[model samples]
Target: MTSSVPVLMYHYISRWKNPIAVSPELFEEHCAAMARNGWRGIGLDDAENFFIQGKPLPDKSILITFDDGFLDNYVYAYPILEKYGHKGTIFAVTGKIEPAAAPRNTLKQVWNNECSADALPRVDQPYVKHELGFDERQDPFLNWEEARLMEKSGVMRVSCHSAWHKSVFISPEYDGFYQPEKRTRTFDRIDSDIIWGLPRFKALPRLANRAFIPSQRLLAAIRELVPQETDAAYAFFAEEANLERLKTLVQGFSKDELGSYEDSMSLQGALRQELSQAKTTIEEELGRPERSLCWPWGAFSPDALSIGKDLGFRCFFTTEMGPNPAGCASRIHRFKAKDKPASWMMMRLQIYSRPWLAKLYSSIRL
Candidate 1:
């Protein structure tokens, strides 16, 4: 029987209690358990060969991946992996990674006795808070220097997540109003400068949605209608009656003033530009060919997949849960790493590594 590999996906290794965040302490526990149980972490090259060419991988072989390339990965996850002799890949948003003057503190320094564990950077600090508006928020991503350091260490590899990791307005249908309290995704089509109180439209991740661009006149008219005071704007949008009024106003706009969706060709070109830029930027910066891509929010279209292949992405990771057997590179399945104990995680790894068990489990759960 051909052996299957389990790809475990993670986002933030932080103290933050979110769906995507696993605490650093628990992450170390997971790594320690993997090493203790004789499981070896494999890289993308090995994964590609095993999945694409039916090449055999070592017993108990697994692929570990982190999405978004958060600074917390360097601060917490990297040292733990190094300690456990495991390899992982970070699918980074190329646009978020900026150049840094020098490398920031990481758990490596504490592990080497150069600094106390308490002195290491924390994810909850003001500078790294993601809740703040984009311009007001300090970058929470791994800088180029940090990424390079990790790549040079042989324990981590950087791949493409996307250029912007943004979502675009898919329809002009107003869903709500954009308030800081309601902002979930890090990037969006709306301008950052126009913070708070913009019309929230139906949106999907950039690669997944054909962008709906409103005419300048329509946008200007809407902005003119918005209350200038922040509290008033929030109160105005909060009323269901106001929403109906806004909808009526929007409905009054001519077809030309409302907006237009990106044509098929235009969407393809945009996808190409966004993805190619990421591929090229990562290659140029890291000095290696980036052949792996993890779609942002695990949202991608047929056009996205086709464009990704043309740009040389060989392995495409999705959020779907399943066992990855030989010859499944285009639709690689991954199970999310949750905030759980090492034993719990290892049990999942066991199930995912076996095709039959994984199928049965997924079926029963679904």
Candidate 2:
């Protein structure tokens, strides 16, 4: 009889400001633990046989997947897996994979014939926040050279994440979100954008000038509501109670001025484009078909699933914290393998290995 095994999901492999990030040390420990134990890594073919053809898996089978295609995946995660004799699948953001970037650090210094797994983290740069003044719409990702090495070695399977992870994070209506110069986001630069935004809006390019900066009155309201330091203003914005208020304030702008920034963010078209590009590019680059897809932020609608099926992606992985139900592997769920220690993950694997326990927990949670 077939049993449901755990599929682990991961994001950035770094020590950064992100809550989703997992440190390299901790990650290595987790992989080592899996290797020390009897856990075996499975490929897309193994998964397809079990899920699509209803074939049972080998003993103690597990699936490791990484999202976003961060360069750190190669720097940190890949070598560890290779050393431990484990395997993984990196669902890469295709469009972000190729940029003429040097190694971030000096370990081995090889993007050419000298390419070894020793010195990487290529491109000496910090993990710049995308929302900041940096044009990080497609950076901090693996170059084709690194990707090809990983894929050819059979240690990691390079699959598809999507074309651009941007449309998923940035609000479609917030034109100012993209324009770092317009960002008075820092505490020291608390100068209200409302004073100069309107004139600048008229002067800038149509697509470039899309953010709806706060009006003078709205700025005053935010100030009055928080009335202290910049931190208080930020706290107010951070609070859930301020969402409706923020919406009301944002609506004060003229529709013509705000443009589609105020429009309901429908990413169906964007998702289609991304999925198509990711599949095509990954296949072209890696010489393998992309059969699985992990959604950005684990947010996907029914329409997205439908579109994915049409695009030939059979497996859809989500952020939902639970085990994949037996015979229902088309839409699988995974828990974040970051933040927690290896021991915690060990316990999670234990629970998942026993279907009855997982079923009981799910039933209670549901």
Candidate 3:
């Protein structure tokens, strides 16, 4: 039987030596190391062929997948991959792809800034621009041209990660969970879409499948909460407290603003629409159809998995750390990059490559 390959996951490729991001210099070093070591990068199709046909993969075969499609991928990683002539798969959040630049440090903005843990102004407020390294107004993500160029190079592949990068299908049951840091901003935008925007959007009237929802209803619910009404402030605070209590239902999960059931379900629908368009456009541009996709944030419900299946995707990848197990429903495993490449990956890969090690790790982890 053909063994599964190590699917290396990466996020930002920049000069910054941060925890989640690796400097461009280091990224070059890592890729060079792989190439020098005789590892060959494989595209999704190649990997699937190895699984389906039991065909032998090249020595050191690896799949390079980048999550959240950072601008740096275009700015930095692209040149390096081109240098090595290796292909990569970029799973991008379609909705978060701004026309120009958006604020970076998104994880920081949402987790630390919004929580008031950091001195920085909350991302939601129209506070005058604070300095981040990149251009403020420009979308912090890659533009259409960059993505197109990468696709044209034949060394990079792009896949859907949902328009909004929110979870779906598994949401109704787990209400009040994860949310974006500029969550208020997103909620406002969605409100605009439902309220003033949808009525004017031609498709809203035509899509018989879309369930009509007024922005005002959501607006009203938010207002009924404590901050909006001071007279009922005491009662409202209690209600808010109750909402917080409901978060624990999703076992082993801490609720983020995006984790809210309403947000999940609504964003899922919004994402599906965006994904449909993206898939069509991408296929047209690439001159071929893609049968594989990666989950946005690696969060999906059984229903979401089923949706992808219905959409005709042959396989889906997940960020869940480890190697892809044979006969494991095609929910392949992936690993993320740290500021430095650690022994963690080497050890895990060894374990995954060997069935005995995998059994040991699974027993310990699961």
Q: How many clashes in candidate 1? A: 1
| Residue 264 shift from truth in candidate 3, angstroms | 13
lDDT of 1 by residue, 290-357 (tens): 78899988999999999999889888999888888998889898989999999998999899999999
TM-score: model 2 vs. ground truth? 0.68
Say which prediction, candidate 2 or candidate 3, comes out ahead on TM-score: 2
The TM-score of candidate 3 is: 0.62
Clashing pairs in 1: 51-327
Compare the candidates by lDDT and give the number of the best one: 1
Report lDDT (Cα) of residue 343, candidate 3: 42
- The prediction achieving the highest TM-score against the true structure is 1
Comparison by lDDT, 2 against 3, better one = 2
Give lDDT for model 3: 0.54
Model 1 ranges off by over 4 Å: 125-139, 179-184, 187-197, 223-251, 254-257
Give the per-residue Cα lDDT of candidate 2 at 215.
42
User: Candidate 1: what lDDT?
Assistant: 0.81
